[model samples]
Target chain A: MQVNGVEIEDTFAEAFRMVGSRILITACSRQWALQAATTMTGFATSVIGCGCEAGLEREVEPEETPDGRPGTSVLLFAMSKKSLADQLIKRIGQCVMTSPTSACYNFLESSETVLVGGKLRYFGDGYQISKLLGGRRFWRIPVMEGEFLIEESFGVQEAVGGGNFLILGQDLESTLRATERAVAEIGKVRGVITPFPGGIVRSGSKVSSKYKFLRASSNTPYCPTIRSLVDSQLSEAVNCVLEIVIDGLEKTEVGEAMRVGIRAACLPGIVRISAGNYGGALGQYHFYLRDILGGTLG
Target chain B: MDKVILRLKERSNIPVEAEAICPDLFLTKSQQEIEELALYYGNKGRRLGDFFQVQGERSDNIVIEGEIPNFKKIGQGMSRGNIHIQGDVGMHLGALMKGGRILVEGNVSDWLGAEMEGGSIRVKGNAGHLVGAAYRGSSRGMRGGEIIVEGDGGSEVGELMRRGLIVIGGRAGDFVGAFLIAGTIVVLGPVGLRPGAGMKRGTIVAFQEPDLLPTFHYNCLCQLSFLRIYLHHLREEDLNIPQEYLGGFYKRYNGDTLELGKGEILVWAGQVA
Candidate 1:
């Protein structure tokens, strides 16, 4: 199958099952809310190194927020429930609580929960006030600027991570442009986030590395400069490649994101749209490129 | 669900203790069984059928229609269901209610929702003294739940309240939230003297300037995000809240130093101190 003359690989993108949580960060203004959200999601790109994968999901309107303030919605995913809880407490307590005029709330509704503000209340040193309203408990911790309000618990549930598609283009400029367009289209999809810098990962890695200590290494087959020295997957005309990784609260959302992203990335000079996988093993979810574009499961 | 309605047949001068009028009790009883429920009329044993005419029954949804100004403890200790009162009710309405809702279309007398563990009580008319307050000897008042009074409230509202929210859309009488352990009381109109007296840890928000006690110390003038969240909740509850009140800065005053001194009274900075 081809989209805008770009070949759609028959292969599938492998994704692992994980746990995720959504946090709504509201502040005195949109700038402050974004500031806190960006800071909290910083250094969180891949769970292998950062212990979690996080990114800004979207900007929330003032009326949609709990405190009626401009807000930002962020999604974070981890390998286990405990890891997600630990990452939440550390990031929210350090990044959001420290930001001026910011309040954090549990944006997800699920049966399973993790204690967030209930534990962060220690920062108040016995001065924190607990408010139970409409069956939801919130903690008000006194800070230097003012009080930092946060919900007692955040809901967590099973999620899908590492949903991806690789953009193979004729040159660096074409590949980068196509990937940017794909990321912009993916941004409009809900419940998914591209947990990478500018939503584009240039150094897509393989499962194994040459170094014994390193569990994974760069995807040499997709590297344009080292094509002659490695088992390159590119053609004579292809010189650049970029990948967009997605993490979503559900498998269907991940599939939808990949579908939209691939459609947007099929510009001129784009060679093919492919996905990374380990022979359909290791991951629980797989998104078949041609099947997804054909509106059916492979 | 068929509602159990009790309409007053005759206006009684003597106060009737109607603790058995709770929805939890009437939930499984038939109309006849509900009418047979016992009551004390001025220390005299009487049947609920003696004064009020019972209608549909065996439902948690109850509707009481009449000027029951002499009836007390209407929904005392109720765990679940809904009670709708169309006329004025006497004292101790919804006291000790655990879960459910009570809607009073007319005025309610003293001790409304006293020591209620859970549930919600909405009074459209004015309320009598000690609303959501603990009994004279009890250490805690309303442990959980919510009480919203669209009209004025009597003195000592939410006294010794441990938890929950109390919103009075109009003026609150003296000593509002006095001896509060931990809770939130929002009075939209001017508060009476000595609000939050002896409160250990709680919040009393008064839109109008209040006559604060001597022990209270002014903290600072800043915008409280929690208050904004609370006001937004109140708006969802269909209360008429002004745009200014939702975003205005408040003058925080930590007070009742005679006790824990952790309690605070946030007076609206828009109003003159």
Candidate 2:
């Protein structure tokens, strides 16, 4: 299959199960809200190195937030529930708690929950105040800037991580531009995030490496510089490649994101769109490129 | 969705122990069965049929229309469903209620919503003393749920409250939020004397200048973001919150130094400030 002259690979993107949570951080102003969100999600790009993966989901309007202030929604993903909770407690305590006039709330209401403010209330020493409103409990901790209000707990559920697609272009500039467009489009969807810096990954990797210490190595088959030296998957026309990775709250959202991103990446000078996988050996979720593009899976 | 309406046939001078008139009691019984239910008039055990006229079938929704100023325990220990009272109600209107909602269209007597664990109570008129307060020896009061008073409230409102919210739209009498352990009390009107006394941890927000207790020390004056969220929640409950208060700063006083000294009293600074 092809879209806008870009060939669609027949393979699928393999995604592993992850535990994720969404947090809403509202502040005195939009700038402060974005500041806190960016700080909290910073350095969280991949579980392999960062211990977690997170990104800003969207900017929320004043009326949409719990505190009637401009806010931002962020999603954090980890390989296990324990790590997700740990990362959330550390990041929110250091980043959001220090932010001026900021408050945190659980964005999801699932039955499965993780302790957030319930545990962080220890920061207040013996001064923490708990208020129950509308059946939801919030903890108000005294801070230097006045008080920080956060929900007692946050909902957690199984999510899909490592959903990715490669954008192959004739040259570097075209590849970068197409990947940028794809990231911009995927950012519009809810319940998904591109954890990589600027929402694009240049070092697409294969399953394992020759070096015993490395679990993953660069994708040699798609590397243009060594295309002639190895069994290359790229055609002679393809020169540069950039991958856009997606982590979403559900498989359907990941599929939807992939569909939208692939369509947007199929722009001028783009040669093909392919997905990464371990040859169906690992990961429970298989997002077929054709099925996503053909609207067969929701 | 069944609705049972009980209209008053006569004004009972003697207080009636009407604890059996809750939604759970009428949810499964027929009108005749409900009428035959036992009740106490002072010291006499009489059938409910001797008092107000009963109508409708078994339902989770109950309506009581009467001059029932002497009716007690109107919704005691109610776990689920809704009760609408059209006139004055006696003491213990929703004592120890765990769930559901109670809407009082007229005045309510003392101990309204006392020791309530969960559910909501909205009073369209005045409420007597100890609304949402614990009993004299109880450790906690109104652990969860909400109580919104649209009119004046008598003394000791929210005393010893451990959790939940109490919103008084009109004047509040003395000892408001006294000995509050935790939770929030938002008084939209003038507050009486010694508010937040002995409070260990909680928030007392008053629109008018409360009769500040000597134990409270001036903390700071600033805009609180959480107040917006709390007031916004109240607005969702159909409480008429002044728009100016939502955007204005508050004069915070950290008080009850005699206790844990963690509680706060936020007095509205008004639009001019």
Candidate 3:
């Protein structure tokens, strides 16, 4: 399938099941809220290395937050339930708790949810207080700056991870331009994030080989600069390639981003576009590039 | 269960606790059976049937009428019933209640909602001391319930409260949040001295200026994010909250400094940051 003049690969992007959570951080001001969110979500690009993948979901008005302050909503994902809990406790304790004039709350509330405050309340030694208002329980831990309140727990949902598509162009400048526009478009569309650094990944990896100990290595097939040294898959015209890794609360949002983003990204300095897949579905919802980019191809 | 029609006959001075006589307990009991419930009045025990006539036959709700100036423990330890008092009620109106609701149309006596664990009690008139709180020697009070007073309130409101929320629309007396371990007390009226004293952790929000003690430490000036969300919760009642209180500024003080320095007293100084 060809979108405009760019070709669309028929392969699919395989995503795996992941545990997800949304955290709402409220601060005295928007700057402080964003500051804490940025720090908490830092170094969290991939669970394979950082134990979790997190990003800002959106900026919330004071009317929408608990405690009635300017806030930001953030999403987090992990491969395991325990890891997800651990990540939240450690990151929130070190980041949100340390940020001045900030309080954390679970974005979703429900029964049978993992208790974030129930676990972190220990930080208060024996002085922690649990306040239940309007059927919702919140923990108030005495901190140096008055008290830090956090919801007892947040809701967990089965999410999709590893949603992606490569942005290929004739040059690095062109590819970056398309990536910049696409990043801005998908930043806050609800339930989705491009977790890569600056929302772009330059060195994509593949299953291991050259080193017996390494299970996965760089994607030499798409390495246009090292085409001669590696078994490159560049179509001669494709000079630079960058990958965008997306994680969504639902598989359909991921599919929607791929549909809209692929169409917009295939416009100027681009050639053929493809995605990464783990072959079989392995109990995940898969999105085919051709199926979404079908009209453009025609 | 036809409410809005059942009216209590006015002018009974019998001090009766109504929380126990909730809907679940009355749905099966006949009017005579329900009226037989015992109540303590003026150092004597009286049945509910003699003080007030049971009007509704098919509902669990009971409407009490007349100037019941000596009513006591009206809804004590009630789990699943609603009591509507049309006249003034005496002390202990809703002590140790676990569930259900009690709405009093007139002023309430002392010790309203003392040591309640669950349920909601909204009094449209003034309430006496220790609303949504525990008395002396009690470590916990009002574990999970809500009390909304439309008019003024007496001292020790939410005193020694371990959990729950209390919103007072009128003036409040001293020690508003004294010894509060965990809970929220929002007073739209003027707060008396030493608010939140000895509180380990809790929130004391006053619409007017608060008299802070020496034991409280000045933390910093900043806006609280959770206040917006808290106001949003108040909006669930379809009530309009003042923007200055919801999205305004305040001085954040971390104190009861004599205790753990974890409790906070957010004083609204007419500033946002």
Candidate 4:
């Protein structure tokens, strides 16, 4: 199938089953809220190297937050429940607690939860005060600036990660433009996050590598410079490629994000849209490119 | 058909022990059985039918219509359902209640909701002393629940409360929140002397300047995020909290140094930051 002159590859994007959580970081002002959210999601591009994948979901209005302050919501995903819990404690404790006039709260509601503030309360050094309001417990730890408040637990649930699509173009600028458009469109999809830098990954990786120590290596088939040396998947007209990876709280949301992203990436100079997979093995979720593009865009 | 109402037959000056008037106990009994339930009228074993007229039963919703200032233990140890009182009620109104709601349209005497583990009690008029407090020798009072009084409250409110929320929308008498272990007491009007006197760990919020014990020391003048959240929650609960109070700074006083020194009393400082 083709969409706006761009060929749609008959393949699927393989996504692994993971655990995810959403947290709200509120501060005295919008600037501080964004700063804390940005800092908490830093260096969290991929689970392979970063131990988790995280990104800012959206900016929340003061009226929508628990503390009636400007805030932002962030989504984090990890391969295991234990890893997700550990990452929450480390990132929230080090990044959010240290930010000025900041407070963190669990935005998601699930039966299963991980103790975040319950463990971070130790930072109070025997001075933390707990408040139970309307069945929810919050801890207030005195800080140099005043006090930092956080919810005692955060909800975590099964999620999908590595929902991605690749944009192949005739040139570098056109490919980057298409990739950016795709990212901008994907941002409108709730419960999903594009974890890579600028929401675009220039160096996509393959599962196998020549080095024994490396679990993944660069996608040599899509590399333009060594097109003649490797078994290239790209046509002679295609010169550059960029990938947009998505992690979402649900499989349907991930598929919806991929559908919008692929449709938005089918702009001028873009040659084809393809996805990465391991011969229909490995991951539990698979987003078929043609199947997703066949549906109507919301 | 909406309720199991009990209308008083006559005005009684003698105290009545009506512990069997709980919604949990009446949920499965017939109207005749509910009237047949026992009660103690001034130390004499009596029938509930001898004092009140019972209507509609086998439900968890109860309504009492009378000014029984001598009726005690009305909803004692109830776990679920609702009880709506339309007149003045005596002491131990909801003592040791675990779950459900008790809404009073008139005044309540002392020991209201004492030692309640869970549930909520809302009074539209004044409440006597020891509201949500521990019994004479119990270690903890009001382990979990909420008590919202829209009118004046007597002395020693929320004393020894371990975990819960007590909101007094009007003026509070002396020794409010004394010996609080872990809970919150919010008095939206002027409070009496020695608030949070011997609190080990708790919070007491006074809208007007309060006379505190000498052991409490001035801490800081700053914004409290938790207070904003709590006030917002109270607003949702239909409490008439001002918008400025939800976004204002408070005078934090670290007190009860005679005890743990972790307790704090936050007096509203208007809109100043």
Taken over the whole model, the C-alpha lDDT of each candidate is 0.94, 0.92, 0.79, 0.94
Alpha-carbon runs more than 4 Å astray in model 1: B271-273
Q: Compared with the true structure, what per-residue lDDT tens digits does model 4 show for residues A1-298?
A: 9999899998899999999999999999999999999999999999989999999999999999988999999999999989999999999999999999999999999999999999999999999989998889999999999999999999999999999999999999999999999999999999999999989999999988999999999999999889999999999999999999999999989999999999999999999999988877799888888888777321
| Best candidate, DockQ | 1
RMSD to true structure for each model, in Å:
1.4, 1.5, 4.3, 1.6
**Which candidate, 2 or 3, has the higher TM-score?**
2
In model 3, which runs have C-alpha deviations exceeding 4 angstroms?
A110-112, A118-130, A135-149, A226-232, A281-283, A292-298, B1-5, B17-20, B27-72, B81-87, B135-139, B174-182, B191-242, B245-273
> What is candidate 1's CA lDDT for residue B89?
93
Q: Write the per-residue lDDT of candidate 2 for residues B158-194, one digit (tens) a residue.
A: 9999888899999999999999998899999989989
lDDT of 4 by residue, B185-224 (tens): 9999889988998998899999899877899999989899
Chain B only, TM-score of each candidate: 0.97, 0.97, 0.90, 0.98
- Which lDDT tens digits does candidate 1 get at residues B181-233? 99899999889989999999999998888989999999898887889999999
Q: iRMSD per model? A: 0.7, 1.5, 3.5, 0.7
Candidate 1 lDDT by residue in tens digits, A1-298: 8999999988999999999999999998999999999999999999999999999999999989989999999999999999999999999999999999999999999999999999999999998999988889999999999899999999999999999999999988989999999999999999999999999999999999999999999999999999999999988888899999999999889999999999999999999999999888799998999888987754
TM-score of chain A in every predicted structure: 0.99, 0.98, 0.95, 0.98
Scored against the true structure, residue B103 in model 4 reaches a CA lDDT of: 96
Least lDDT summed over 10 consecutive residues: which range in candidate 3 chain B?
B3-12
State how far residue B16 of model 2 sits from its true place (Å).
1.4
In candidate 2 chain B, where is summed lDDT lowest over 10 consecutive residues? B219-228
